[model samples]
Target: MTGKSQIADRIAARGASRSAAAAAVDAVLGEITSALAAGERVTLTGFGTFEAAGRAARTARNPRTGEALEVSATTVARFHPGATLRARVAGGSGEPLGAVPDLGSLQGLTASEPTPVETPVPAATSSVKAKSPGGATGKAAAAAKAKAKAKKADVKKRADAAKKADAKKRADAKKAQKKADAKKSSSKSKGKGKKK
Candidate 1:
């Protein structure tokens, strides 16, 4: 339910001018949009990642008209929330919602009032550890740890595959260049040795 204006207001209440807060919000959104448009992923450690995802073309039907149509393949913006944001939404922080002070009161308060302290959200990695304590003895904890380990391993595997592919590409380019150079040298030698 929170919109950009609400976010801007929150930042403005935190001693920043309304214009500055608005500008900051706009700059962040602009950068995220630009990155997504450029097919790059933007990851905000404890917030989320924004990326462009490909959707394959497919046939679809209209429910009301029973008409068939073709959908074109395209890239769409996608967001995957990081653990801290997900945990906060799931009420895993153990802190009551009421504990978060009302920002409305701060609007009218004088400068003499203490500035609200913003509690830092735990990092996504720390959040996972918080969910699965070291001394815990349960199948759920063990499963969670195994799943996390598997996910980490999968990421590493993908990175290694990409690195290998890049190296292969470089090697192929070098091989092509060497072949072309040898061909040019042979052609020159043949012309030099010809009587005509």
Candidate 2:
């Protein structure tokens, strides 16, 4: 039946025996496995890298009895395709296998590229302000209050002064009227004695 050995012969080309091609493929696989076991990456030209990665410990459940189970942490193999392989799969360049695609004008576009932006920072703590505390706005309000108070005091003083002046004028006019009445009475008495 057709198997891996036949596939290898087809890849290796003319004059390569099935056993020899299989041995070559085994050698390459063995090398990759060994490197991964040693915590090293095995890179294949135009293919990809074979890496060892850790799987974290987790709790799993059994389906049969609904029982909880613990899955231990372990290392696993991971394969990543190379740039040429990715480009070919993506229908980039029409070039043959093992060749990098020419992405004219967009070559360097990548997720890792840096971009510039501005971030705002709050004002410093040392510059903290208690708004309207004994400042110009407060001073203006106090001055207005004091001016209103002074105006009331001045109005009261002027009213009291005018009352005192009016009382003094009434007293002087009453004294003058009493002296005129006294002079008229004395003249009438002198004229009556002469008639007798």
Candidate 3:
């Protein structure tokens, strides 16, 4: 949750003015951005790499409507932290990170405070992710099964109603036909009796 202002605060704690710290933060971000924009990789030895990668155009789907979507080809930036930065962030190796600013401040650590242990961020979207192999998470699968069951129920209900309606219509037609036949027979009988 820490942003540029927070980062500036840490640098300010190091005796630089707030404005100077802010300017330094902006300058570093700007240089990294410019390098990535020019399709170059900016690697700070013990920090991380900032690079741009091209993505191919592809078709994707809208989950709710099950509709297809067109995704245009584009370039995207990616960052892969280096071993030293990773180690320090993970609280591994009690040795200090060489030349890097106090990572502690970024982690809300003041010099008086010890480095806090943190859980690593997951790389995937957790909603559909598995907790472990063959285990625990089935939210997406359960949702799909429920949706299919509801759809089948809806179709069966409509079909049953249609069949009942058709049966009722045929019975009404048959009754009308029987009534007409009775009327014709009665009229014939009356005509024959009158002629006699």
Candidate 4:
């Protein structure tokens, strides 16, 4: 995965020391994380915008058990890729993107408020409901919860197995020690009798 280390390596290759490059990456990420935690947004020019959005409480179905459950409202971080970034990923040649938003305009925009765009919808899917762009839906939260529970159970099972293996190892080591001691004592006793 192209993580912080990989980015730092690239930066270091460009002339900055490795430590300095790593520090720069850490500082950037740290600032973004803290800003999001404080209910703010961090916009990287020509990269993307990161912000926290509120998710409304709703009823969701559990994917594993197929049971209906109520999920509480929570805020989740969301990212909207900038036009430049999107273009870099998706090859150009389509309609050119609009003018990039100025930093002043971006700063004035709140995390919860996204710029509105009007799109013409065909009649085929007009009656169907579409997911809200504000934040994650109930189904997404439920799926995340299910995955987390599975991971926790797997970790616990592995930990219990590890404990049992350690206990057995210790017991076997003790038995071997006792057998060695008994053999040494018997050999010493026979040696003393022979000398007498």
Q: Between which residue pairs do clashes occur in model 3?
A: none
Model 3 stretches with alpha carbons more than 4 Å out = 92-196
Which residues of candidate 2, in runs, are more than 4 Å off? 1-3, 12-15, 90-196
Candidate 2 Cα lDDT to native: 0.61
lDDT against true structure, model 3: 0.67
lDDT of every model, 2 decimals? 0.68, 0.61, 0.67, 0.67
Q: Between the candidate structures 3 and 4, which one is better when assessed by lDDT?
A: 3
Whichever of 2 and 4 has more lDDT, that candidate is 4
Ranking by lDDT: 1, 3, 4, 2
Model 2: what TM-score? 0.41
Off by over 4 Å in 1: 92-196
lDDT of 1 by residue, 9-60 (tens): 5566556666665556666676777778889999999889999999999999
Better of 1 and 4 by lDDT: 1
RMSD of 3: 15.5
Order candidates by TM-score, high to low: 3, 1, 4, 2
TM-score to native of every candidate shown: 0.47, 0.41, 0.48, 0.46
Tens-digit lDDT track of model 4 for 171-194:
999999999999999999999999
Cα lDDT of model 3 by residue, 1-196, tens digit: 2345555655665555556665666666767777788899999998888899999999999999999999999999999999888978898654322334543434432233322222233433332443222222245556667989999999999999999999999999999999999999999999999999
Evaluate residue 183 in candidate 4 and report its C-alpha lDDT on the 0 to 100 scale: 99
Q: Give the TM-score (vs. native) of candidate 1.
A: 0.47
